[model samples]
Target: MLLEVIEAIRERVGKDYPVWCRLSAMEIGVEGGITLEETQVVAQLAEKASVDAIHVSAHLVGPGRRPPMAQPPGTFVPLAEGIKKVVSVPVIAVSRIPPELGESVLQEGKADFIAIGRGLLADPHMLEKVTSGREEDVAPCICCMTCLDSVTWRDEGIWCVVNAALGREREYELKSAEKPKKVIVVGGGPGGMEAARVASLRGHKVILFDDGDELGGQLLVASKPPFKETIDTFRQYMVGQVAKLGVELRLGERFTVDLLDELKPDAVVLATGVIPFVPQIPGIEGKQVLLVSEVLFGAETGERVVVIGGELVGCETAVYLLQQGKSVTIMMRGPELATNVNPLVRVPLIGRLKTKGASILTGVQYEEITEAGVTVRTETGERRTVEADTVVLAAGARPNTDLLTSVEGKVAQGLPVGDCVKPRGIREAVEEGYRAGLTL
Candidate 1:
């Protein structure tokens, strides 16, 4: 049937225009699924049918079906190489092929061409940046899969965490501000950085303040886990952008009323982010208990670690601890693990935890934290203690409204963006930050 369709299209086009056949080189995580050798045979057949090129791709089907966005760059290049060996026609390799990897793929004769999909969505000027030798300016796709997840799960339009101007190029176009203001942005998280970047681009004099010595707020912790280092790329891009745009960076200094009075800016953007929510469980204040940030930030952990909260943060933290060769368990009051995580990310993340021997307990009530471990009542109404030497709290966060309430009515134009308004993921933070900058 595929050959028939190819023939029909070729006959109609009279071989004048290029027509490429995209083949799933491998069906990952599926029993009896398509294999590379089979795909090579398919590619040869397609070439006989006069297909101009064979595009090597992959599919994660059955229960493992997910957006290939999470896969490493050039994930399918080997498949393309396999098919190229058998076919005379060019083979196009895809699946998260960034420019640098694509160039190496070509040099190594892995593929004749590299097809970039989501990377283009994140930064439409990707090729332009590469051509102009300004590749560092390209906004990177962090593989959050928010673009695919929005359409697949929510039936909504596409959204990119790194590129808020996506699908709204005209509306988000940065025009020189008719009246540029002195903008004071508080917090150095994604939101705060974004606010400063946009405002500076609009010709505003922007000064960004953060208590931490470094620029990244939660990203410093978010990027610590394995397979999540891509987040740091986006963070670095933002930091570089703000620096390049000449946004004043006042790190290691909190945004207080004293600073506000001293700067006396025309507008204030509060991207103060969030603080860890400490639950009322007894002994949570004990020295054995640590926040999620503490663990991710290199705090010493015991041989046995119990992480409270089974959401994305908790699960990822558990994975981090498991990688550290620690016995780890994740406990949550809810009935599900990684319920707040995107399905594409949750599947592999949960699998990693289980594969690494993580004990996941859900539908439980936290009774208390003790020197031994966390005591909880399971769904079956049984009391038990999950033995652990350390208790890490991944129980979510509350909006850091400290600066928000303090600056209310003090500034003529004050806006609270990102987690200061509500504690959510990167998408909300970045989008809100961009909007707040536009609002100002």
Candidate 2:
């Protein structure tokens, strides 16, 4: 079977030299998956057939299968190691391995070589930077699954939030501007910073204004959730990029109409980000009710907590709070939790939620918040009140576009990017921000 396929490939290409095809050999499909021993059989066969090399890879469909999650960096290292023991030809392992980890894998004799996918997308010159001993300059991939999401999440097209050049390699290239323009960017969020980074790199005199003394916008809050430490790494990378590119950051400066008028910049970018949506439910005035943002920031909450909404924010918040020894019950109007989360992260999240003893009530209708707890109506019209001392609001977010609207038409070109245009995740924010910078 292997020889037949190899001959067909060689015949098609008509190459004098080796074509050197690669195979997963061991794939974990959405339903039925192959085993390690099975992979060994095919790998040996390929080597006997005079194959030049073997590239080890693993495919994951989603969660709720046997593994319940897609593996991360070095996920196939063990598999590659297993194949190396059986096959004689060179073996290569590929996935999320970073430069340091990939080096260690080789030094430890795990695999002959390592290949990176998302890491390269995040930092196009990763090899150059690491080789030159300037690893700090490399933008790190946080493994947020946003790049993969560009495909699974309705074919949004490929774009990396960390590195805007991934999708638009030619358009977003950092070539100096033909004529440098004075650019003023409002907000220091992901979008705002990305805009500043790109514009300044393009030889624009860029100044970024943010009310807070530090950067990161709402990423500061979002990064506080459990297993979200990588978000901070992304934040630090963006901040560093803007600074390294010589973007004049005006931290602790508010952007008002008067400020814009005074600056008289050639172009302006608005990326003020979003505010949490507090649903107008009865008894919302009670001090016991808190927003998901508040809970994440260490606001005082009772032992028994009831979280509203079951989206990515709500589900993750539940896990965050539960890890702190708070009993959690997640109630949502939708029938599912983290419905939009990538299957890789969502599978383990859901599986952990089940075993952690946290309560999950889906298809629920929120009635009101009470001092004791929350009153919810099930999909079947069953009114059930879950007793709790604290209620968290994770309904969603509303874009903070005041800066966007106020600065409209006041400058040579005013652009509303990121959450100012629409409340979205970091992916949209960074892509739009990069485009905004390129336009200037």
Candidate 3:
């Protein structure tokens, strides 16, 4: 199939464009499907078929199996080197190759070129910065997989936590204002801070306003999760950027449309963020039932807890609870747990959760919340009850669009950005904020 596909493509495109064959080295089963001998045979076959290059990768086809490329400690280089010996064509090797490790792989003659997918995501200009000798300025990828999470959980486009300017390059650009205007941004959150920074960079006098004590908005809640330090880092970067650009920041100030009218600025950006959706379930309003954010940021709960949603938020919260030495059981109406989460991040997380003895019951309809725990009717029509002292509602969130509507006709130019516009993850918030900033 590989050779025939390449031949068909070559016949159609006339071989002007380079055509490379990407093959996975490992498969399921103890012996492995494509051994070193099979890989050499495939490489030789592709070379004989007049292919431009051969990219060798280790692939896994089951749940909880980590991709060979993403395996820790540089285990993929030997396979690439073996494949390189058999084929005269250029060999490309990939697996989470850090820059230092990637350089070593090339220096040691393991492969002609090293491929970095998640690495480049951690820093989009990785190769450019490394080659140009500006390595310090290069933002390091924390490999938290938030970028992958955005694609999986939110069903949105890919984005980097460090590089806020990615994907919205066309929308956000540094342009000198022909006639500079005074801009008063109404929130110091991600979107508001970003707007101020971008507007200031574009030669506009900008004043950022936020009622909150800090500038992160919903990002404050995000910082509490495991492996989510980068979210806080990006938030700090945005705050520092605002100060560096000399944008006037007014913190802890309540913002209203009347204030905007008094200032009479050119534009107003609302990044008020979202409010947690509190469902009207029986026993849900009690003190025992806490929001996921509460558990993430605040005090610990009882020994046994039942999380009421199996989405990414619920799963992570469950993991956090498990880490705190609590036995957690997640009940969801959905078909699977954390189905929206990115495959790259989810594989490892699920493995960890299973090892920690986390229980997941999917496709179960919520009947009510009781003092004992949650009562649910399973997909099989069985009445089941899961007991816990505390019940966490991680179902989802709703947009805080009330402010957006309130300031609709009050401001000359009204722009809605961040989770307030639509409840989403950090990547979407940053991208939305960055684009809003560029537009100003």
TM-scores of all candidate predictions against the true structure:
0.96, 0.90, 0.75
Residue 44 in candidate 2, Cα distance off native in Å: 1.9
lDDT of 1 by residue, 123-214 (tens): 99999999999988999999888888887997767889999989888888878889999999999999999999989888999999999999
Q: Which sequence of candidate numbers ranks them by TM-score, best first?
A: 1, 2, 3
In TM-score terms, candidate 3 sits at 0.75
lDDT of 3: 0.77
Clashing pairs in 3: 69-95
Q: Give Cα-based local distance difference scores for all models.
A: 0.89, 0.83, 0.77
Local distance difference test, candidate 1: 0.89
* Model 3 agreement with the true structure over 1-440: per-residue lDDT tens digits: 98898889889878677888887765643344667778789889988887988888875555555432235645667788989998988999887676788888899999998888776766677788789886654555656666666677766676776557665565555678887877777777667776777778889898888888888776677667666665676677677778888888889998777787678888788887777887777778878899998898876688889998888788878878898899899888889877876677777678767878999899998888888888889989999888888999898999877778878787667778877888776656666766776766
Top-scoring candidate (TM-score) = 1
User: Which candidate has the top score in lDDT?
Assistant: 1
Q: Model 2: clashing residue pairs? A: none
Error of 2 at 183 (Å): 2.0
